[model samples]
Target: MQTPPPKSNCKSILTCLLVFLFFQVFTGTLDAQEWAKKMFATLEHDFGTVAKDSMQEFRFEFTNLYKEELHISAVRASCGCTIPTAEQDIVKTFEKGTILATYNTKAFAGARGATVTVTFDKPYFAEVQLQVNGFIRTDLAFSPASLAFGEFSLTDKPRMEFNVSHAGNTDWMITDVRSKNAYYEVEIIERTQLVNQVGYKMAVQLKGNIPVGYLQDDLIIVTNDVANQEIKLPVSGKVSAPVTLSPSSLLLGITSPETEINKRLILRADEPFTIESLTCDYPGVTFRTGSEAKKIHIVPVTFNAGLSPQKIQATITAKVNLNGEIILKCPLSATVE
Candidate 1:
């Protein structure tokens, strides 16, 4: 401060600052690429030429090379045509995980490309994008591609309708519809037949006795196309329970030892019911219900972090009075720091 810096000296100082900033940005980008290269064996997959109505899948395997634990927060695809799934989100040092990419050739035809982005939060924040490309021939066509029954009750039978059409052969027909699940029944009706086209209406029914939870299966449509005969249609829906728990998975994040954490959960049902008991396998967890009993309920859960840092996996079971005692299990997870 005694002698203010000259103009040239100030300019040199400013140039040094700019160089430092640029070096930091460049190093960051290089670090991210190095991390990804050490983790993934391959970052792209091409399906070349895939047959229409055929299922194609690829797995991008990665290993955690860092000493700290790695957790994948989310895996998203650029298009709805490609479905990406993470086998396990939390990976320990030297452990392995997989990113599964499923391409729906029936729903999307021609040249298609999608990029799957995997975001990591634990240890540090980072993102890696994987690319997938494929070409689907247009021999067979399904109107809806898959059967979605939406949200239906366990006591109600749901029905869905879709169409299947073929381009070249008018004699093409669906020989039979088969499913391994006994809860599903199918009926096919011939709608039209032309010189170069053939079409049919398919009616799929779900029985009323199906259990409550998410439903995901495939219906094999055996066809007369000798070259490509078997066509699979994915079936998905949720069979909601009479009593439902909102926010089924409660994550308490990171907490200090001996700290008390409380969270509120909402229970909804189609009719009035009373909670008989609420319990958890972990000794440090407890819950309490409101005094009033109706179609909606508020349950407050308390968790006491133990004396040491550890990971917790406790299933909170709730017994409700319906036709009989109905037990619902909600998974709860937390990390103590």
Candidate 2:
């Protein structure tokens, strides 16, 4: 290699160093400014005292005061029981927006306090938390009232368990367990622990006959915990019934430079049930279930595959046998190519 160049001049080196330092300082100031601007509002109201069975909501509003377009990173509630709804668009800059939060007073009776935090983009990108308070009925409340088991594969049995905390601090009893649908069932094993806290081990099982589409049902747990009537907990999800595809999976048998092909999958459930919901994890995937079969009793699941990847998996949920007391579940599977 050639010899290294001669050393630089002291003045030139100093000038280069100053230039770099200037850029660093300028950028730092710009960043600091971006974090300083904001205009916000919230439902920040109090309901004071309320009954046990009634449900209510609290909404908040916010806006961008920056000269440039503003963006909101996220808006989250302190707890899931307090549902959060925010602006639909993310890249909204210097525009007006709103965030809505609905607190389910279901299991929250008596005096209660909760908060929601919102984050935005600017120089001073910071999180602002808002609070809402009210009295909730402590007669009977399901801690972690809502159960959302996201997306699961056909063979996967997703599960979660929560506690029942009383505000009145009174000891109550769960009398009976039942479901509106038959395909799925739940079991409650009574046990006492955690110092004065009492409840049961509730398990919901879906049968293999579950169709591919949407599945939903409610578990009506009759409890002396409440006055007279039984409280209900909803269990819901989308199901991907059984499916079959030829030469499964994408990019498997491709030999030509630009090969074009088409395929389909037949999806159907073994028993009758209504598809409560249908969801997909992948963008290239699609599904079709019941419109005609409103109240599915024993409907055939048909998955029509079209240029979809082979060897894909999905799960569907539904409510079956809308009567009597029983514990059961519906599970299904499908193949792609």
Candidate 3:
């Protein structure tokens, strides 16, 4: 053996090792900010030219791809022309959230833009900026601003009408109306021309072929104005199933054999509907419903664990009246301990 190192030198070497490890961890945290940026698919949206007093909205959607919970610590907008909001605060892994940027149509007009900053504190601190800009014409406006269809069934063919007026120009005319959505059809039903003013009455109809989900689209109107060629109208509605089910899938966590669980299955429709029958092939699973025809029915289901512990996977089917017979099915899952 030649010699052993001194105690002070050994201590200094150990300190260097600790510092190297800490630097690695700190840099890793800084790199995670890039992960937050990766969640957004796009960073900017241009609303172009829109009619004043009309609804202009855009959603900056982001999904959490990490294992940790993604969170929005704060949300802000650079100007009052664009109002920003978070759909929720904390989003779990693989789930989606939206940063809604809504233009302030009632109060402000003319060209406007905003920067929406979203701050995340969890899964590492990060900041994301989203941009939106639009030219809101004061001379052009919609009487109702937007087409809101609310809720309706697939069999119901609904039509709504609104008027668009342009001031300060007598020669202004709507050349044509256009829509790229197959489920919704839009057209100019009437036109009124006056000295220094022009107007149009437009109608939108929801077709029967639309599936059950939220309906959202923009109807573009081509105008004769050389500077601004198109005006957009936002349309929103929901095409609901005659017999709708809630909770998506039943998630009954681990339980004991002596447990008797009571759960609810909510059924709703756009119109008054009656459930002709409810069936389930799962052993020890039973259900009961009301007999009256109504817009909603609450079906109470009871689950008995029997005498042993096991996993349960089953499906519940319901028959309803929507001009004829319509079937709705839902999945049920549970584990007994």
Best by TM-score: 3
Please provide, for model 3 over 1-337, each residue's C-alpha lDDT reduced to its tens digit, 9 standing for 90 to 100: 8899999999999999999999998887667667787889788988778888898888888867555888799999999999999987998765668998999987888889999999999977888889999888999989788888889877787999999999978888888777776777778888898988898888888877665666777788899899899988887888777567886666665678878899999988778888899887787788898878899889999988777877676778878776777766776766677
Per-residue lDDT tens digits for candidate 1, residues 242-294, read 88887876767678999999997788887888898888898998888755569
Per-candidate Cα lDDT values, in order, are 0.79, 0.50, 0.82
Ranking by lDDT: 3, 1, 2
Q: Please give the range of 10 consecutive residues that has the lowest summed lDDT in model 1.
A: 47-56
Q: Which lDDT value does model 2 have at 97?
A: 63
Q: What is the lDDT of candidate 1?
A: 0.79
RMSD of each candidate relative to the true structure: 10.2, 16.2, 7.8
Clashing pairs in 3: none
Per-model TM-score on C-alpha atoms: 0.54, 0.34, 0.66
Clashes of each: 0, 66, 0
Candidate 2 achieves a global lDDT of 0.50
Ranking by TM-score: 3, 1, 2
RMSD of 2: 16.2
Quality of model 3 by C-alpha lDDT: 0.82
